[model samples]
Target: MEQTVQPCPQCGTEIRTDRRFTTWCSACDWNVDPVEPDERPGHVERMRRGIAHRYGERLLAEMTRGESPRPRRDVAGVLAYAVALCVHGVTVALFVTGALLVTLGRGGAPSVLGAFLLGLAWLFRPRFGRLPDDAPVLHRADAPRLFALIDEVAACAPTSGVHAVAVTAEANASVSTYGVRQRRLLTLGLGLWEITTPQERVALLGHELGHFAHGDTRHGVIIANALHSLNSWRYLVAPIRNPSGLEVILNAFYLLPFLAVQGVMMLLDQLTLRAAQRAEYLADATSATAASTEAAVALQDRLLVCGPAEALLLRESNARQVRGAAKRDEPGQGLWDRLAAYVESIPEGEYERRRRVGVLRGHSVDATHPPTHLRRACLLARPAEPAAVRVDAAAVAAITAELADARQVVARCVLRG
Candidate 1:
C-alpha cells in the first residue's frame, strides 16, 4: 500500500498517513466534518470571531503548536473561594443570632422566627463531607516498595509529599486531599494495575502526580466543596410549590439570594474549568517525561482497550461465578488472565478503527481533558528521554503482595455485582 502525507488544509501542519482518510489534524484538532459542511459561509467567520480572553487565546495557540503553556491563576477561582467563605460566615452568623432570639424572645413571634432561622442556618452550614479514609489503606510500612516508587515520582512533582495510599476496585487512579489540614492521599485502582505493564504503570502514576504538581486535583476539591455548599443553600432556600399568592411572594423573596449565589458559582465553574483541559495536557507531558513517550502512548492505547476488554472479563467472571467456580477463593486466577487473552484476540484493523474514534472526539463544555490524539501529538512533537527509574522485580512483587487480599476482595465484589 502506498502512504501519502499532506498538509492540513486548515492548519498547514503535515497530516500523518494514518489520519489522511479521516482528514484529521492533531495540531489544531481540525477535521473535515461531513455532518457539518464548510459550504456554510458564515460558519468560518463565526468561529474566527468567537469570544475569548487574551490569556485563553494565547494558551490555546500554544496547545495547537504542541507546547505546554504554564497556567495562570484563574480570577473565577479566587472569586469563587471568596463567595464560599462569605456563605460560611453568613451561615454561622445566622445560627448564632437565631440561637440568641430563641433563648431570650419569651415565646412570641420572634421566638418562632428564631427557631425557623436556626433550622435554615443549620441546613446551610458548610459541609466538607468526610472522605473514605477508612477504606483499605496501604501504609508505607506495609508497601515500602510502592512508597519508594511514589517518592521517586513525587520528587519530580511539585507536591511536598504523598501522605497515604488507598487501593480500590476502580479502574482509575487519583490524588486527593482530605480533612481540615488537607493531607494528600493517593488512590490506586487494582484493576488498572493488574492489566498494565510495569512501565505503563509508571506512566499512569506520573500523570496523576502531575495533577498535584499543577495543583489541578486540589483545585477540583475546592470547586467540589463550593458546589456542595451552593447546592445545600439552594435546597434550603428553594421556593415552596403550590403556594398561595402571599406565600408565592414570600418564597420568591427567600429564594432570590440563593439563586444569585448558585448562578454566579456555576458561571465561575465554566470560566475556570477550561484551564483543567490544559492541565490534562501538561499532565500527559509529565507522564511522557517520567516514563518513555512510547510507554505514555502505549498506556493510553491500553486504556482504549479497557472498555471492550472489561466487558469481556465481566461476562467471564459472571459465568465462572454462576458455575460455582469460587473465583473469590482463587485470587491469582480469574479475570486478569481472561482480559489479556481477549485483548490479544482483537483484530489489527478493528483495533486501529476503534483507536481512531477514541482520538478524534471533539472538545465539549463538559470535557475535562484534551482529546487523546492531541496529547499524543504534543508528546511526539517534543519527545523526552524516559526517566532512569525502574522498579526491581522484588519491589514489584512486594507491592503486589501487599495489595493481594484487597485485589481479591475488590474483584469478587465487582464480579458479584
Candidate 2:
C-alpha cells in the first residue's frame, strides 16, 4: 500500500511512511494514525446537540427519527463554540464586504480602503502552523520492543492504538493530534524516561494514552484553532506601540472593531478551554485503569518531586555545557544519575512540602490540567490495584540502547532552545 506523507501530529515533524498500520517519525519516534471514535452510547447525538445548542436551540429534543434526547447542555462551552463560529462568520462577512467594496470603488478612496482591508484580512487569516519538530521521531522498525510496549499499553487502554511516537528533551510526556485528520502522536521526553522506573514509565504512557479514551484532544484541537485565529486577528489589528498622535487616533478607529470581536472570542475560548480540566481527571482515571491506582498516584508523586528537581539540574547542566565543562558525546547515564541523586538529596519533608504547595502558586485559568493537588486527591480516593503492567527487561534494555542517539538529538535541541 502507498503511504500518505504528512507531518507528525504531535511535533509537526514530517513523517516517513511505508505500508504499515501507521505513519512513523524517526525524528521523534511518534506513531501517527487516526483512531476513530468508539461507539459511545449517545455520544454522537450528544455532540450534535452540543453543536445545535450553540446555534440557538432552547428546547432540547431529537428532531430526527430514532435519535436520543439532547444531552444536558454545557452553557459555557456551547456559548464559547458559538462565539468562535461567529468569529468565523464575521471574518467571511468582512472578506465579502471588502471584495465588493473594492470592485465597486474602481480606484476611488473606497477602493484604497477596501484594498487595505483585504490586505489586513489576508494578514490575519486563520493559519494553523505546525509546531517545531525538535525531537526524534521513531518507528516499530527502529525499536520493535519499545513499539511492543506501546502495543501492550494500547491493548490495556480503551483506545485502539498509538499512531506515532517521539522522544523530546523536556521532563514531560504528552500526546497530541495534528492536521485536520486528527492523527494522534505520542511524545516521551527523554528527561522523564531516563529517570523513571519501568513501571512508572508505563504509568506515564498510560496517563498520556488515556487521553484517547475520552476523545478529549479531538475537540480540543478545534477550540485551540478557534483561539489561534482570534489571537492572530487581534494582533494583526492591534495598534503599533508608541504611535504618533494622528496614527494612534487612526489605529483606534481600526482596532476598536477588531478588539470588540476578539474580546468575546477570547472570553468564550477561556471558558471552554477551562472546562477541559474534567477531561484531565478522566484521562488520569484511564491511566489508573491501564496501570493501577497506586502506580498513577506514585507517578504523580514522582513528577511533583522530579519536575522542579529536573529544572534545577537542567539549568546547571546547561551552564556546564556552555562553559565547556561538559562533553557533548558524554552519554546520558551520568545526567540521569545526577537527576536521581538530586531528587534523593531533597528532604522527605521537602518533597511533601512541594507536593502540598501544588505545582503553581495557583492554577492558571487557561491551564488544561487540573491542579496537582486535585489530581493527587482524586488518585488517593480511587480503589487500589496491583500493578497491571509488567516490566519487560529485554524491551527496556533495547529501548535504552535505541535512545543513545536520541540523547544526543535531545541535547542539541535542548541547548538550541
> Which candidate comes out best when scored by lDDT?
1
Residue by residue across 1-417, what tens digits does model 1's lDDT show? 124578978889986554223445656656533334335435423332232223334444586575544555767657656765665677788899899899999999889989998997877665443456445777678777788888776666544557778876556688877667777778887657667888888888888888878767225655666566667777767788899999889797988786787675556455555566667767776777777778888877776566665576577667766967554566543656665665655544334554566444333212455555556666666645576456668878887787776666666666665
Report the C-alpha lDDT of model 2 over 1-417, residue by residue, as the tens digit.
Answer: 345578877789876454423455555545422333465436534543344233211111111122321223377767876776776666677788789889999889988888887876676565443434756877667777777777777766656655667887677887776656666778887767766778888888777877776655324555565676677776767777889999888788878767775567647645654355555666666677667877788778777665655585568567766867346556555665666666555544344545545533224222445657667676666566566677778777888887777776766555434
Query: Which candidate should be chosen as best, given TM-score against the real structure?
Result: 1
List candidate 2 stretches off by more than 4 Å: 1-73, 94-131, 217-219, 239-244, 325-328, 364-367, 412-417
Off by over 4 Å in 1: 1-60, 64-69, 102-135, 217-221, 234-262, 324-328, 344-351, 358-360
Worst 10 residues of 2 by lDDT: 56-65
If scored against the real structure, what TM-score would every candidate get? 0.73, 0.71
Give Cα-based local distance difference scores for all models: 0.66, 0.63
